[model samples]
Target: MAPKGSTFKSCSCRDETGKKLGRKCQRLNRPDGRWSSTHGRWNYQLELPPHADGTRRSPLRRAGYANQTDAEAELNQAKELLNIAANDQALARQIADLITTAVKTTKQLPSPEEVRRKVRTGQHLNITTTLGEYLPQWLQGRKTLRESSRRSYASNLKLYLIPSLGHIRIDRLRVADVDRMFEEIDELNDLITRARETCDPVLRAQVKGRRRVGAATKQRIRATLRSALKKAIREGLTEVNVASLVELPSGKAPKALVWTPERIAQWRTDLDTHIATMSARRKRLWKDTPSQGHGHNLNRIDAYVGAPRPSKVMVWTPALTKQFLERAELHRWYALYYLIAFRGLRRGEACGLRWTDVDLDVGTVTIRWQIIQIGPEIFEGQPKSDAGEATISLDTSTVTVLRTHRAKQNAERLAAGDTWHDTGLVFTDELGRSIRPNEVTDQFERLAMETGLPPIRLHDLRHGAASFLLAAGHDMKTVQETLRLSSIAIAADTYTSLLPQLARQSAEDAAAIILNAEPAR
Candidate 1:
């Protein structure tokens, strides 16, 4: 029997009341029976050991291992893992080789604060609480970008980015997780475009085959998001900046639709049928009329009577432009097309015209205000730039068109008499006020649907004008000025469809000039 005071070799039995007993302290005997720690110290049980009577025991296991060495090692590993998990960042990296050597679960586990302290050399991080709040801030600092760029970002976010990423926490966002989330954006864009095919009037709906954000714009948004994190870091809000280490997704260019002349023409014509612009223009005209008049007098007999202002110039694409002219009723629409197409005047410039601005003798139109859209109010503003407000020479055809249109307006003035408003706009309704921009766009669309013309839009007249000029052997610098394109690159990019034939024609012209040159006599 093992001694009670010293370490045991074997158990010494003692029955109840301290009476002498034999084999009672067997290795299998527990305090109650023969299978517990109270037995001599051999713990080799498969599960819970059987009683001394030879009955099999039910199965059970301890939380930890039996051997003291094994238990201590496991306890240490658990402590290390807990410590690492405590970090504000998942950047708490572990080295596989040093697993046994490190003092991790020094007897038990470390607290989150203690673990955090040990790993955070200098960094701090917090998870994104919500996605919507961060995106507008990301867009605010983009002041230097072109209006087109800013508009694109605003549009794309509203349409694509926000709906997907809005709910996720910014800090908790991971590259892998974001990648997974966005994997479907491409598919969704495709589905959206396909679904809208029957419904889309312009067919200008975008489908993202590749990433839309440019490398530079992506950098800007990332910088903005990072700046927010930097503020958090500066304020000691976190121990690590997760955004600092994150690698952004590839900034590949998006696949764009081929803007062919035929396609442009088709879309222009198609839009008129689907969108209700014709009715919109008529509504504006009706609102301007006196209750007594049955319809607007195409020929105002009284030249002194005022006219209702024409609506704002609608955006027209190449396909639908013809419908606007046919429906405008006044010969003025014909002249408007010539000015927009040949003279390259903006909607406001054309609308703001007086009989004085046009010189049939000189075939010139002086440009001044091109119209400005300021909130609910319509106001006159100078053209985009000083150069944009200059006069343009027109050809005889345009002059003839204007002459005819002028005659029609004079007749309308004569007929309206006291009922007409005296606004001096050349393209006015029977009552004289400048037309609303929205009404003009709507008119073009309605005309397009009614006439079944190619789906050319009204603003497309400008494109058509620019395209025509480029095709006529004009230089890009001149075209840029004529179109008032913000830059030369823009003129080339946006109007490429118009210039394909012109490009080949130019080469042929150059070839003819070179080969047919006569030697000096």
Candidate 2:
């Protein structure tokens, strides 16, 4: 109910021009006007407090109630809505605005839920802000994300998210809308798969040779959406996070497979046969194929016919790794390769190693910095994790190799004299500049091919190191520490394939410990 001294009045009259003069008749101004039971209507005018600018506000007046009871009911509801004191001008204004909107729209009173949301968020009940507008603002406000992370988030927003979900209002987003976006992505991937399978390799390359977005990419896109929605929720823009309710295709972690003896033999067989067959066919089909002079080269039919698609991460067995090292020993970057293969140093970490971080006398190498490539240019950054920036104990043999490598580098510096760039990197080009990461990968590939070894990616050498340690009976914890992995779980997960054999011995040892207890049989 409203405060004391509130009531409803009625008015009914006609103009001399015979118009139905609603709220405009001169009789409405009378102190004791006669009530018309059949034609007069009830009216209430709420006397509100002054406005925020210290000016009087026009009373919230409404008419057209059929009777005083109806008029009193509306007056009661309005009083309940504006129950705040006069000094709470902000809230008083909100109630005034709410009633004005109700009158204009002629809708029912705002629901309790809607009313609470509006007051809590300090926004109108109806918000028109789009996800597209909020996402950019969210990215700008994220000050702690790394440069690489920010770039990734921006790419997802601009290239994938904004085009799909940007126009939809944040509060209006639905789970079905997000699901439809992913379904479209899946349909496009199907088209990409069909195109790749049907077209010749040369034609596919000419068609830009784009691959379908993978499960991992989709997962990342969802993560970006979830993060943005969380920010919106924090700002009280929306009540629920629809993105959090979405499900995506689970991404599989790439397994690290070692180049065992059987795999090595199989690889050798495939390479020899593939090379001989392709060589013979190329000569015979030279006339049938597209001309090489115009640079519109013909695609190799052999490439499409059962060409090898290498695993993402593959490692060499100890013997093959030793052979590879021996062959690569004659190369200029021998020490770099040795460090990577033996010490499990990442390519970027090895490239980023400075002389100040290496302690040959102490037989320890302190890893601190890494050179990360973004597009063409590379810059120095911290290690992958805090644990990655660690002091790794080196074998005496590795120390000797580093000593010799330092001597060779000094000689090159003396040869260049004033021309040497002096980058202070342990591994560098002849001018003492940091080596490009791609150059290292390409060189490793060429060396592996020349040595007639089974193919494996450069990063696989680090996997091989972990496998070697496990095979030599080192604990997973030790391997984790040596690799500077953040946790033992990661080390174990990465090398789970090598654990069963070691676990069998431990299982037998456990049985032996309890052998004194006789079996029931």
Candidate 3:
């Protein structure tokens, strides 16, 4: 006999009308009126507790067990799960609803331990949430992320993560699925590359303004996914972070290369060739469409051939640096350029520096703030890292230049009188307003080009500072401290190639030590 209290029994025999006889089937009972064992499959039902709102709930029902033992085991498991919510009606209702949904959909019972964990943590009891559904909610709840970081996470989710893997159940996400997303990104990259290379305007237009998803960006996307899944794990939504298991190509930064005489020569030749090739292509395009005048074609070619840099990163030699600075000395923001070139201040840092942070007598400047540009807006923010906020020692020449720049700024302030906006920044416009970081960069580029030196970016001034420190025989740790880098490894990795002069001098010194050594036993 099956146990009593919301019973367990078996009945598969159907009446002639074709409806299941259910518990009323005749074979369910023996001739003596005891229950029969082999007539039909076993099933069970139990009265569920009332809902949290005190409304009635249908009794929990499950069927299709092989025998009474199987039916009793499942019934015991259900009772155990329902017992987890003892004394908490809301939790009881949640567990009952979860069981009902699981049976109706997947037919798989959630583990009792897992359910208990979700309850204890107050996580969502629903186990069927998809990543697409959860990621946006997770991102919305992240109240402390920096604006740039939040934007990155949002972009990754909208463009890559959600579009590719959103439909998969969060619990069922696997490393292979993540890997396939990156594979699709790679395929798209191939398409973009081909589209950009094609001469046809339609082909080019199809991929216009779409940059390749580089390895570093791929790494960032993975980081965003991993972070989301990590929170999910903490919330008991997932058992594993499949994103952490996938491998990716190294996203190491490109080492800074010093622009030597030979490299500059080669770069000039390459730039000339690139311009000529673009000119020829433009002419062909113009020939194909005679309605587009030659002037329009020439202007387009000029815009397209805007002096592409030879490398992603390049630094200047001491002589070149001197030439550029000498030319920049005539510019109004010469002190800004000088501070960055010598003291390793970033563009934003220089623009953001205030007179109060500078100690002319002590020759130290604290880097507590930086002007960060997000899209078109500018805002003051903390330095990139804790190390970036520390005070850096300024050279005597730099102190003198800053003093002069202060005097010039004071004069400008006097000239503006009531109109002057006293932002207190060291670098500002004639009206005493804070200088935009991009304006500083544009001025740097213009001065650099005017100096007739090989091209380098405004930020490359930081790289040049590292090279200068290395060439002057400073140790890597010293360079790290001077540059205020977060780690010595960053300094070493970026400046390992060093200036050619330093390498040559080291080579000569090593050879001399061996050549001058006397023969020994």
Candidate 4:
């Protein structure tokens, strides 16, 4: 019956003659069912025992095969796994495609979720679109900022920071971007000091120098940028403060050359002669030249002469308070200097001084308001701070200085007749207008010139005033209070220098106190 209807290829052959073979070659089963032959050796996939939950498991969890049954089972499981993987992948693609379609159809910018979805689906997004959208939302609803501070930040943003960092999406700001920005800042020479020309090209070519900002300006920018970035982080716009991380370029310290008392005394003698000679000539020439030109000429001459600041006005001394009482100058400002030195008035406080603020009868000067000029803008304003409003103690000597100055002013007032400009100010211009501190600095610079001393600024007078008290054995706390300094460190750092002669004098005072106080031992 033809082997029960089976289909098989048979080769007809004879043993040794051309005759039909009664017996054909034995049938061989072709390799099948996940089994393959390698040089007559069998190879196949493996299958593991099922999990306890009746789920099929893989024997060749990673690779290779075990036996026939195991191989068959593994082949079956792998086929199923590959099918499941394909289906899941297709579903994920479908979902992503649907999200993209919905976003595009709705005419909406993709949310962060959509961005992640697009990324997962291998899509690209514009960085600026992603990052810039978050900025305005980030700045909303923030309070606790001062008006002037806000204005400064606004100006900085409009003028500098935004112009540099705008259009660069936050995400686009990588380490490379940071490096490039720093490079740009370097390339433009946007720093505090110019670079030194060196032979080494690598260092010279490198963006090695830090970004340099002036201390006062740097302090302001740092404060503002900190607040801005803190707001950025709070609103989840940025992960870090890049500005905070970058090192600001360092600055050279101020070189101070305060004159010694001996140097000051010598310079003062020379200055007196020059000042007397100049004052006489200046009075005559003052009306003929331009006011600014005259001031400029004097300043330039003073600078060339290397004139020191006024002895009492520019350089302070331990006995400055008492010395000012003795060698009172024009307007007797030395007396005013002593008032602030002893009593802690702002130069404006001293300038704003009134015969009324100075109660010679009671030896107290009441500080209520101050007359000050920022530029040419002049007005009476509240004392710069709360500490500004306080009573200053005047010594009997200060009272006497003031009484004499007041008498002099009074005589001048009478001489001027109807033009006394009775503002009751202790210090005044020739027109009796309140004396500007700039004018004071100008006078100080001229005085310093006249004295044949190194030129010093008027604010140095404030420094000198504080230094004298510290040298005279006052505590930092007392000096701080006396200067109305916001902090003790400010009082100490600007003042406190030890003099060997002062140390010897202190030793002598101690020795004298001990030797003179005790009986013969």
Candidate 5:
């Protein structure tokens, strides 16, 4: 184990002259000698050279024991480490050096657990690796992530994580550091809010330089750090995930607010006042002094004054939805509006719909694919989840809209002749190419503005559909199925705002049931 003839021997010195004989001195060299009381300490010479190729050449030796027993025991421990290391010559060298350093310099042994971990993950027990250095490698190895997901991860890392926590060592990262980053982010949000509130061009230009990072954005940034740290743990870079320990302001799911009669009235009144006042102010300002900066200044002023802060998830009442559908009939993509408003198809799902996925004969459409957007580029990808790919039964009214839309589309195709592209989609541009999702949203906004109705995003149409179903007394589970949400909990949480109305309806139904009972039979 300790090489041939490698055993405990006491340092002997009978001669005090010249080289002084060292361990080869004659007095203490005898095997049977209980003599030489002058030799007080025992020493062992164990040779352990660098076993790995390209490793720096170094002598591995440990000594200075009070007795031969102590010397042999230390030798046995080194032998055991060599046995464990086996074929890993690098590990064997590290273990040898670690043991040697313990005996010679510090007289303290390193933990066996720490030693093995360094060897396994190739971290070499170094505690100075920064998050910035590690996260890039971690993301690079995440080859299985989709394009959109990868872009999101990269964006969070570049825009938030690296800028904030890049220089902090992986092992030295603390929960306090993570918390401070979020606190700063919250402060940045306040700055953005102030910038938007101020109409001063210089103040707005200075403060509105960066996009507002909201609570949702902060949560995503935390998720990115948490995910990266998890990889570090698996690779044995750090024992604890500090990111997991930090807490941030939890982003609440924005409740979808429906436009009631009072809200519609307020919206109309505000719109008329804003337009009339803005027109008069613009005319007076231009007549007084037409400066070069007048146009730019007026645009900025209008953005703050006239722009309405829409709810995160806004919905329209049943009457408003009906009116929207009736007006949308004049639109070329009336079938698209009808399908989303009734069936609750997502914007991407509606855009990705092909004729093959839709069955006009059976009155059903299978949501199999969705057009996902990363920046400006769009690609047809599978649904967000397995539940997202569902076959929804279309109502008779929707089927009729589809038929009429198909007839009109056929007429357009005939007129275009060879110029039309054969995309075979249920909804597309006039040239038959796929419609951009953002274009659809912009069109929806313009149309809603034209109708003088409350503003709602195109995605909110799906929320309206869910609200309609719940209002009709359908179970939450049924709504979950119709929307193709991954779980009933999501459906319950999202539509929980509607529960108060449902409760009143339930109460009325209970009273009617009792009143209509037949003689307590």
Candidate 6:
């Protein structure tokens, strides 16, 4: 039912003296004292509820409705909006303010349904809330997010989304605005690249510590925006998610490449050239400033002269893996390296493994936890994903190695006595404390160097495990389960690059099968 309001005809007809007669125009009323629809426009006026502060507000007056019915229909909508607040005076004032502002600006009434939803859901009643104002609020409300996820969302909001799209009202944000943000990011990347390549130290310093925002990072930023906007939509803030509509390049992981002879030969040549260049640069620096100590110059050169890998991800051949294990046999964490090389345990998983989770009698090890390093702080958390937490079957060789490691650990515990930390982790330092994940990686790197093998990251040992599994005639599904990957597609895409011998055998087998086939008779 429509609220009490005044619906009357009004016109701009003027008297003979040229003074405009608004509602008092004589033509608005007929001789019988009824309103003449043909002579004037319809308008409605209604007094609104008092403000939250108890002060009176001006009535809502709208002009130029076609007839009385149309004017009453709109008036009913406004009343319905006000009725939504019920006995809550504060809510009534908010609805009243919303209607007044809408009519004044857009010359239209606010949608009653939309207003009711916003009020009921405790969403912001104003449509002018900018991304800048709402993104932080949305992030603050996400209390259940993991620490790493929260950090990522906060970084994307602060570093990209807020700076690019924050000022624009969320409802008014468009796809083009989001596209422009990425375009600007690309431009910034180009600038950073140019700065790094320039000889001027000032230009380089300007971009120091600022890495190029890669496609993967940009995709993550987009995901953060999309998630925030989805929450905003649920809160009735915006009707569209502009972030989802923006297309981006695929952020696929680089394929793991086996360190074959050809690539290794090229890498060795590159390393030699790199070392010579660094040697000349070092001499030039010393010649320019003899006062600087020889040790300082050598240290600086050494830092820069470390050999660069031929690819982002490189896996050792089976022979190289064996050689590395042999060299690391005397090392304290040899079992850790052996497990990662054979069982494909992630560095963090190896660091976090406990004796309780290992079952040599059953020839299986359960992955329950992992030690993660966020910045410099180490945390014990669940595995990377649900699939990452599973029981992996171990071979007899691995069981024997683990048994030896346990014996060594017991001896160390007795030697340390009360000084031992007693972390109970299967892989720990001599003092029984859980080893840092980074320390494991650093030791693997040093071991790989000592064995004089092609350089590969500790994580690449996991990749090598996948290759070995494939080479041993295990199917893709078996490899997926053994690796505890979340999906077979991920296992297929990442580890499908076969080793050289496997590829050659596959090709030869295919050709032999075709050549040996009986011809159609």
The TM-score leader among the candidates is: 3
Which is better, 2 or 4, measured by TM-score? 2
List lDDT for all candidates, in order: 0.50, 0.75, 0.81, 0.51, 0.73, 0.81
Q: Least lDDT summed over 10 consecutive residues: which range in candidate 5?
A: 295-304
Q: Please provide, for model 1 over 172-269, each residue's C-alpha lDDT reduced to its tens digit, 9 standing for 90 to 100.
A: 44555444434555465455533233222222244322233334445544454455556545544444455456566555423212234445466545
Best-matching candidate per lDDT: 6
Q: Report the number of clashing residue pairs per model.
A: 67, 0, 0, 8, 0, 0
TM-score of every model versus the real structure: 0.42, 0.64, 0.68, 0.47, 0.66, 0.65
Model 5 CA RMSD to the hidden true structure, in angstroms: 11.1
Residue-level lDDT tens digits of model 3 in 201-293 = 555576664557888899999999999999998988887899999999988777677776677888778767766766676677667876655
How well is each residue in 292-386 modelled by candidate 5, as lDDT tens digits? 24422334333323445345676887767888877777888778988999999999899999999989899999998787764466788777778
Q: Over the full model, what C-alpha lDDT does candidate 6 score relative to the true structure?
A: 0.81
Give the local distance difference test score of model 5.
Answer: 0.73
Model 2 clash tally? 0
Better of 1 and 5 by TM-score: 5
Q: Kindly list the per-residue Cα lDDT of model 4 for residues 91-187, writing each as its tens digit.
A: 3333333333433564332354544443444433333333234444433444655333344555545434555666666644444544454455445
**Model 3: runs farther than 4 Å from truth?**
1-54, 58-96, 99-213, 284-311, 411-419, 499-501, 505-521
lDDT of 6 by residue, 1-521 (tens): 23457788889889899988999988889899988959989988888987877888888888898899998888787778888878887877788888888888788887888777666666667687899999999999998886557766777888789999999988778999999999989988887754432223445576664657887888999999999999888877877788899999987778788787778898878777766665566566556666644611333223222567666678887878999999999999999999999999988888899999999999999999888764455778777778988999999999999999999999999999999998889988879988788777767777787677878878899988999899888888888898889999989898887655467755666787999999999
Q: How would you order the candidates by TM-score, starting with the best?
A: 3, 5, 6, 2, 4, 1
Q: Where does candidate 5 clash, by residue pair?
A: none
Worst 10 residues of 4 by lDDT: 1-10
- Model 1: lDDT of residue 295: 32
- For model 1, the local distance difference test gives 0.50
